[model samples]
Target chain A: MLPGGSTSVTTSMYSDGMSTSDRLIESTRELLWERGYVGTSPKAILERAGAGQGSMYHHFKGKPDLALAAIRRTAEELRASAEGALGGPGTPYERIEAYLRRERDVLRGCPIGRLTMDPDVVASDELRAPVDETIDWIRERIAGIVEEGKEQGQFAATLDGEEIAATVLATVQGGYVLARASGSPAAFDTGVRGLLSLLAPHSS
Target chain B: MLPGGSTSVTTSMYSDGMSTSDRLIESTRELLWERGYVGTSPKAILERAGAGQGSMYHHFKGKPDLALAAIRRTAEELRASAEGALGGPGTPYERIEAYLRRERDVLRGCPIGRLTMDPDVVASDELRAPVDETIDWIRERIAGIVEEGKEQGQFAATLDGEEIAATVLATVQGGYVLARASGSPAAFDTGVRGLLSLLAPHSS
Candidate 1:
């Protein structure tokens, strides 16, 4: 409804029957994923969403506000994706492996992980809380599973759940960095495989 | 020598009798580290370096050319730093631990790893080469030590050197992402500790 031109040309759902605010937030999410917070701009969001400047101001305070909405959405989505695997039926190791092997655009990198590289995201508490919460949520979830694994004797009883959880999280996030840096998914796969090898019992 | 401001006014090492090329490359490196390739601009580089706009174009073709020079320098510096620890005296695990525990600006993140998040850097082959090569070089270096550990009976002979090396690299790179996201170095230390635990033999 709020548009420079008709919504027919723009591929994004921004100009659809959706609320102007929702459209802006969705557009911001995509931009943030591709260009990050520092690289994304207000004009680009408007252009990509086919929404005009007035609509953006009317819906949200500014770029940062819209970005917050987008970032929160991304965090929720990430948690959902992770939960799908972590909460699925399996041993702790299997669940962890499933989460690690979840379909990912290796070259694109993690949306949350990529944000950490953005100075603006780290500089603002308002912007950083969702990221911090999401990471903590994941670490806690993985730690719970790891503890369960230890209790079941699936893992070494002496294993530290929180530390193992942190390592697992690190492997995935760092895999994206390595993959993107090399412009190949091989580096990511290698990292994951290496971690798995270390995780397995010596007999396995 | 080429500048629009008095040498004393500028804080960087621009007018310290350094060659224009060196000044340009150094300025580009610092800017790239802080702002990334897309966020950094030629004008900003010149201003920061206290070099004239004319000198930038005269010394290099454009941003990409200057960026390549800067990226190569960063790659070299990173290699040197890694060598200092990886090539130092110790058992393979000890050397690996030293490299992982080396002093770093945990909040600032890895200079090369940060570049992978930049769309401009990933999109260009030339810009990406140094990053790719640097990662490859480090992985290879780590793998060599791991191989030595296997031969020396410090590690399981069945271990894959390249794979373990990739995992170590991932832990460090991913640790930065977690630390930056949480605004604390605790996550980084946890990741390192977890990896170390996994590497040590259960009997030991």
Candidate 2:
């Protein structure tokens, strides 16, 4: 029934298929991880997505818009992954240990960590807000668990929940940077082990 | 008189001009902090250093050569600074605190931290070794202090020296990343304060 088309409206809708917006976002994520913000180009994004110039322009204003969407999506994935581990039932120590020991592609490096290194990415609030929110959310979530542990008499009475939480997060992130710089996972393991040992006496 | 030159060889020897190699290395360090390895260009280095094309090429073969020199210089500087702080006289705990509370331009981020974010820099051993050495040196230095504290009966007998040292380095490096990401110095202060509190009981 569509004008100048032989197919029915439903068929035409099915034929139009893949959403250009989704394709653009997926392409942006991959490129951003591989090349970072300053290295990625609009042309590269369009080509990788297999979407024409007009289709991309129609879906997103430009590269920055597409990048913001990509960064937000990355942030969501990071939050979901952290919540999955932190929100589970366990002692605060157990939950934190699980989060640290969770299987990770250590050599590939953290996507958020990669973004932080990009000067252009960090300079823009639109790009950085999601990254900041993700880390902040993580620190707060961990701190909450530590607070509950303190109340339950699991951690030392003198323990500072917020500071310990900050220390925990900093260790993991700093571990990644150390591991990558050393070209081995030894430093990362050493750091994590060191943190775990510090928490061992506090575990229930 | 030397060969066909009018000036004596002694005249050339008396000149205090910085060698082309030294100028190139210094310029690369500044650019690396601002633009990272992937973003900085040879032309930019030469222009910034006020050295000509022939001068740069005559001293260093290419960008990689120049980068190696800069990395080594940065590593040496990091070692010297740590020694200056960690080598001072005090109770081990006091010395550690001095190192932690030492003035820093937190927002500038650690020069080595900037390198870890650069994908290309991490991929090259010639560039990454110095970064690793700098961090390892810090951890060992601090670990020795913690050990000395334990020996002096300053810290609890149960303390883990190496672990605490790892935590110290990790917190500072991680704090910089968090602060830069959030565009606030509060995160840095929070991490530092938290770390200091952890060591509070050890102070005597």
Candidate 3:
């Protein structure tokens, strides 16, 4: 589980009261984050979730089917979390800054971004679709904010909204790699600070 | 193999001309890039390199031992490649631009960066050392250049070189993730362009 994740919620989730299906998905999501698809197996999923083989088969067809549900849920959660700051009242740059500064498991990496490195996930169109769509949606949402910034003259008229948005996304996704590779959140913070300074030079 | 990689050189490397140790290292490097540590096995490496099991065992203790050699070689190669452009005849910004615009196998992603996502790679400090050192070296090199740029008044005096260098590295490493996720090099290109524009607004 992620650092600071609610232990109470986790305990409640795995209790007998929770449905087997929900337990299976929650476990899959956690396992998938820690281990890529190739490293994860049905037995491991069942073991982590405390579900029996029969219960797993009853809930989903197989590993791939269960993985899809987990991936989709993760993607949805990412979108919701980003939207919490993105949709809040602020200038475009401020909103972007908020999104970048939001608390993250720096060493753990972005769940959706990590999938790109997973051979199984990249090989399957069905598996890759949600990952692709999630990235596209995030880019588009940031682009929309950038466009608004340009309209308000907060950014130079010549700046390309979509392109800048893409850069912001890249900085973030890349920051996780930097953090994880070095085993330090300092790497992530450095990138974020540098980008913010670039975006709002005189202010900083 | 990468686009434009010397076919004859590759054939020669795989042929009887290449020594068993060389073949083992080369094969390990290729497999590590494609399958990562968890997905790669000694059996698969031997088969790919066309070496016998005895030869692999003779050359290295095990998969982990072989991976260290491959990773060190890769780190050296990455440094040499970056130095080619970074140390070339141009301004600091120009050198950075050249480095960013260098031809890459976009869909394949960064071999070093990819390892950061591998659970086995992250868990083993022995395996992760080269990756960590390589990234640190690259960032330091970039910071040196950014410092030179600031000294030359090419960038704002208030800019932080190390921080900006980290951001540059993140944009690149993250760009690879974005490109792989979307199955398009366009994402990568957009990021590069966006960052370049930010660096030199007048030029763009």
Candidate 4:
């Protein structure tokens, strides 16, 4: 795993009461985040989930099927987490600020964003769908907020909702890359600070 | 290779007269970008370069050594490419604009930025040195330009050089993630356009 990465999340996810199928899914999510689709192996998944060799096949068709489940679950979680801030009680700019300021596992990188870098994930349309949809969803959601901000004058009249939204999304996705490259979250924070300043209802 | 990636670069680098060591390094660079460090293997490198198996062993100490040389070359090239725009005749804002607008193989992503996602590359200090140094070097170089902009009143007085510099780098890095996710370069363009607007220097 990368520094400050998924070991505890993987370990704590398991409960004796958790169903075998749930274990399998959770384990896949963790493994996919840490190692990616190409680096993740069937043996590794089974070992991490603490499932019997045959348990995976017993629950799902195979690796790709199980991966789809994990990815969907991850996408849903990302959307929910993002909505918590984007949909919260605040002005458009403030709500957008809330989303940007929300905490993340910076050094370990974004779970869904990491899929974009995975050769196997990007190669399979089935796999890439959830990742692509979720990013679009987030961008669109943020664009909606920006649109609100533009109407209310928090943002400049010249700002394009889609463009500003894309910039907001890129700052985050790229912030993780910078943080991981240096093994520090400081760079990520600095980027966010700069972005917030730009979006600070000040004219440019 | 990716849909629009390194085959031509690799093919064009090799000629009958080129030394075995140079072929190995160039091939390593291409493979590393396409498959990353873990996915890249010695056999694959040789096949890509059309060099003998013995040629690798005869040239560098091992895969790690060759990777180091390849990464350093890549870093050097990235810095040189960046400086071409950054050091050109323009105001700080325009020079920074020149750097961001420079043509890139958008889908393939930034080669140096891609390495930060590699498990083997980030895990090894030796392999990661050049990648880390290059990103920092770029951030600092950009920061210097931002400082100049602040001094010349091209950017707002409140803007910090380091923070805005990190934002600039993050947008490019994150833009790649977004582009690769959608399998389109449009998101990257949108993000850059938004940034330029924010940096337009008119006021707040």
After superposition, the stretches of candidate 2 with alpha carbons farther than 4 Å from their true spots are A1-20, A47-56, A201-204, B1-20, B156-159, B202-204
Candidate 4, residues A1-204, lDDT tens digits: the string is: 433243434444588898989988988998788778877888878877778789999999999999999999999999999999999998998898899889888877888998888877887899999999999999999998998999988898899999999999999999988888888899999999999888898654
lDDT (Cα, 0-100) at A137 in candidate 3: 94
Model 3 misplacement above 4 A: A1-13, A201-204, B1-13, B201-204
Cα lDDT for residue A156, candidate 2: 68
Q: Is the docking of candidate 4 incorrect, acceptable, medium or high quality?
A: medium
What is candidate 2's lDDT per residue for B1-204, written digit by digit as tens?
112112123223323486667777877887787668887788777776667777777988789888988988988987888788889888888888888777777766778867887777877887888888888888899988988888888876677887788777877778777787788877877777766766665333
TM-scores, each model vs. reference:
0.93, 0.85, 0.93, 0.93
- Candidate 2: which pairs clash? none
- Interface RMSD of candidate number 1: 0.7
Query: All candidates' lDDT scores?
Result: 0.87, 0.76, 0.86, 0.87
lDDT of candidate 2 at residue B142, scale 0 to 100: 93
lDDT of 1 by residue, A1-204 (tens): 124234356646544578777778887887888888989889888877778768888988889999999999999999999999999988888999999888888888898889998888888999999999999999999999999988888888778999999999999999998999888899999999999888875454
True contacts kept of each: 0.79, 0.42, 0.76, 0.78
Task: Provide the lDDT at B14 for model 4.
Answer: 80
Ranking 1 against 3 by TM-score, winner: 1
Give me the displacement of residue A98 in model 1, in angstroms: 0.9
Error of 2 at B119 (Å): 1.4
- Per-residue CA lDDT of model 3 for B14-90, tens digit only, reads 77878889988998898888778887878777777777768877888888899999999999999999888889989
Candidate no. 3 TM-score? 0.93
